[model samples]
Target chain A: MKGRSRGKVVARFGLLAALALILSWLESLVPAFFAAPGMKLGLTNLVVLVALYRMGDRAALGVNLLRILLAALLFGNGYSLAYSLAGGLLSGAAMILLKRCGRFHMTAVSVAGGLMHNVGQILTAMLLLDTWQLAGYLPVLWIGGMAAGLIIGLLGAELTRRLPPELFD
Target chain B: MEAKRKRFGRNDLLLVAGLLLLGVALTLALGVNRRDGREVVVRVDGEIVARLSLSEERELPIEIDGRIANRLQIADGAVRMIEADCPDKLCVRKGAVRYVGDGIVCLPHRVVVEVAGEDELGLDAVAG
Candidate 1:
């Protein structure tokens, strides 16, 4: 039983990682209409949130980090890797904290995560370029992040509701 | 488990509403305080290459290492990237920026074009 459960865990992790990678690739195919360069649908985050709720923080962190690294290697460069690492790590941490608090639902947690991700990216940009001028871009980013976060959160909540609880156990 | 069944509770509604309100407030505040930029500063590899007045209407081709990389145009109290050799052409697609703090950056070419001038709200102070 122990061996079977371990295999199941590995299989689940592999499936989630592949799904997240595909979602990330799909998001890249969609051209960004916004003025900001890094803005996107953040579709892969849906998988991260699902992993966080189902398999706990360790699983979520593993899935999130693996997805960013895989996506970076497959389709991006060093700059994209930096941005994704900063954004994904900060957002994942925020989501985990919010989830633990248990005061709000997945939507709210996801919203906060989305906002923090943008903040992390912007901060990274500021550090790389050595300019405070980038802060001017925050208002637009905030608005965009909020809208994207709300949508992702709603979708994540719905997906979590439909999944079998015993599958993760 | 019962709580998971409810998609959104009062806290969720409050959080969403609060975030929306904050976004709108920030947008309005930033929009109102934005001032027309007096100069367009172009940088290559983080070094200042040129400073052009927004009042002047002209096109300047930027060269990096003896190779033309980007074309910058200043007209009608605004600045824009008209052309770039970069594959993505993100800088060209950014359109025109008239506000004091607006910037157009081409990461591939390491080129940055930003507006610099006096504004009612000091972004530097806020960011600092």
Candidate 2:
């Protein structure tokens, strides 16, 4: 039973990771919609959010990291790797913490995740290049992130409802 | 405290509103000091490489390791990255920056171009 369940966990990770990568690719195909640099629909968060609520943090983080690495290799570069890692790690941490609190809805957790993700990316850029001027760009990203997060969070809430928690909890 | 709250309920709405307010407040505070600048400052790997006046029309290639990484163009009192060898080409897509706090960053090349003017002093004051 133990071995079988472990296999299930691995399988779950693979499925979710693949879904995330597809979503990333789909988002990239859409031409830059907004003038704001680095603004993204962050469609992959749908997979990560669903994993977080259904399979927990380890599962969600596994999916998120796997997707980032695979997507970067296939479609991005080293700098993009660093940027995505910063955003993914920070957003994952925020979502995990928020979910653990048990006081907020999935929408709230996802929204926080979205906001912190952009914050993390911008912070990484500032540190990497040693400039504080990027802070001015933050407001635009924050608003855009919020809009995208709201949509993602709504969808995530629905997804978590349809998918039951897996056995690994 | 509302553990039994529904998804995107009053609590969630309140949180969203609060975050939006924070974004707006930040915009006002950070934006107040920014103004169109007279020159663009280029930095390579965190060091100032050039300060070119925006009034002049010229193109400059930002070189890294004797290889041109990005082509910067200055015209109409604005600066844009016309070309970049980086994978994302985000710097080129960022369009033009004319405001004092606006910047075009090419992360792969570690290049930053920003506008600066006499009011650039406001930047230090704001940071302080």
Candidate 3:
């Protein structure tokens, strides 16, 4: 019974990955409403956050990674793969870490994840350019992260509440 | 239920406040000390193709004109476009960023104006 349940869990995790990829592609179709470069709705984050709550940690990680790779293949420049990978990994790690904390504040975790993604992306750019000058954008990214994170996080919370616990479990 | 008990610590507020103030200050400083004198380098695919060091001349030579080349200005340590054909002149209106993150981006042109810094020395090692 345990083995069968585990298989079912893995299958569900695969579905989550597919959902994340589709969300990623759909988000790209929506032109950024803001003026800042590199800004996007990041709608895929909703899927990742929801997966984190329902699917268990390994499933969440798998889904996030799969989405990043698939999304890069679908709509991103070849050169941008590294930045996206680094940013996604960093952001996902941040959110997971926050989730593990006793507080487990989903909203705060989302904000932290968003902020870290910006920082991670900027860090990669800085490292690649060998200049700290791009660091100036960090604050802008942080402010933007706050708003985006809050919106995404709250949405995640609502969806999680409505979802059948077994669907995620 | 578990996450709600945690409140933002003082440190978090302080850090956020510091970042905001820094962004505001940098934006203001860049706005006030606008200069018509500076040097600019345009790079694409991490290769430098155009270099413009400012003179007193107000007219700028635009090689690629699209909705992207709104208007150009060189101030302090930066070169920026104050106007553009792009419906969103956010790039043009940004004036010139003297510090890092200050770039002249022609999204339509796929052209970028990035401030060259000491890190240029490491470019060959990484990109090469």
Candidate 1 Cα errors over 4 Å, as ranges: A1-4, B28-32, B64-66, B118-128
TM-score list, all predictions: 0.88, 0.83, 0.73
Docking class of 2: acceptable
The two-chain DockQ for each candidate, comma-separated, is 0.48, 0.46, 0.21
Which tens-of-lDDT digit does each residue in A25-107 have in candidate 2? Answer: 99978766575567897999999998887777898999999999999999999888989999999999999998897777888
Encode model 1's per-residue lDDT on B50-126: one tens digit a residue.
Answer: 87888999999999879998999988999989999866687899889998877888767778788878552255335
How good is the docking of model 2, as DockQ?
0.46
Model 3 bad stretches (over 4 Å): A1-4, A129-131, B1-37, B56-78, B81-101, B106-110, B115-128
List the lowest-lDDT window of 10 residues for candidate 3 chain B: B30-39
Over 4 Å off in model 2, which ranges? A1-4, A164-169, B1-5, B64-69, B83-93, B119-128
Worst 10 residues of 2 chain B by lDDT: B1-10
Better structure of 2 and 3 per DockQ: 2
User: Which rank order by lDDT, best down to worst?
Assistant: 2, 1, 3
For residues A43-91, could you state the per-residue lDDT of candidate 3 as single tens digits? 7888888888776567677888988888788777654677778888998
